[model samples]
Target: MRLRTGDGGETIDRQDIDVNQVRIGLDLSVPARLGGLELTPSGTVHVRRDGGAGQTGDGIEVAVGLRAVLGTARLDAQARTLAHHRAEKATASAAWR
Candidate 1:
């Protein structure tokens, strides 16, 4: 679990724009061994609120993933979704080591 806050500003031409936000996140995972392989399942959630011009009111992100390891080989796969006022996005990724 984690919590964070941030403030930022940018200047373009002769105008200044500012943004402030607070975010909280939590992650959980469990691992189990089956024979010679280790398998883990994990999930995460993040919530955020923003204040400033053109900023979205609030947002949330959710994700789930799986990881497997055996000897020197490791594999991971994850899918995530981010949703906010007026827009939503989704992503997925996999990696091998």
Candidate 2:
């Protein structure tokens, strides 16, 4: 249970919402030449329902990604896809002193 307030300091209840979600993930570590690499793979299933009506949506997502650390440089990449959507992201950064 949770409580929320508006600008006028009025209490609001959100117990009317019913939601279900499940997530599973796995991680692996492998030795790298300079540093190390971590492999992460995961999946998720979720559904939301409104009490007032039958408004609802369900989605499933799967993603496999990796993060690599080499000295002062860091690299990350991930590929994800959903039952109705798709997304891919990557990042790289380095620092010098």
Candidate 3:
């Protein structure tokens, strides 16, 4: 995912996505004196199968991120399921200006 904002002084741009093969998204925000912030959330979902009928399997995954001048951070979360079993994971980070 990618997100960018200009110093236009107005907040009026955003986007999102979710699909079977791949997913991506972006967001934008105007600059502010106190604090300017922008967030982008995106992920992918894929499925693969073998040649045999019983060799087919599927799963899901996702992630999210945020960026800013004052403070920047990103969070990622994912979940997957295969053969009736499920697993999930998450992580986060931050930075100072």
**TM-scores of the models, in the order given:** 0.64, 0.36, 0.24
Q: Write the per-residue lDDT of candidate 2 for residues 1-97, one digit (tens) a residue.
A: 3455564454456545554544444444454453254333333343222123333333344445566665567777776555332212322222222
lDDT of 1 at 21: 79
Model 2 spans > 4 angstroms off: 1-15, 34-60, 83-97
Residues 8-94, candidate 3, lDDT per residue (tens digit)?
A: 354335643333332233333333344354343333333332222232223333223333333555343433332221213422222
| Runs of candidate 3 exceeding 4 Å displacement | 1-35, 50-70, 79-97
Find the candidate with the highest lDDT and give its number: 1
Comparing 1 with 2 on lDDT, the higher-scoring candidate is 1
Clashing pairs in 2: none
Question: Model 1, range 1-97, lDDT digits (tens) per residue?
Answer: 2334465444345565678877899999999999999999999988877677654466777789999999999999998876443322433333432
A best-first ranking of the candidates according to their lDDT comes to 1, 2, 3
Q: State, as a TM-score between 0 and 1, how close model 1 is to the true structure.
A: 0.64
- Model 1 clash pairs are none
Compared with the true structure, the alpha-carbon lDDT of candidate 2 equals: 0.44
Instruction: Report, for all candidates in order, the number of backbone clashes.
Output: 0, 0, 0
Error of 2 at 96 (Å): 37
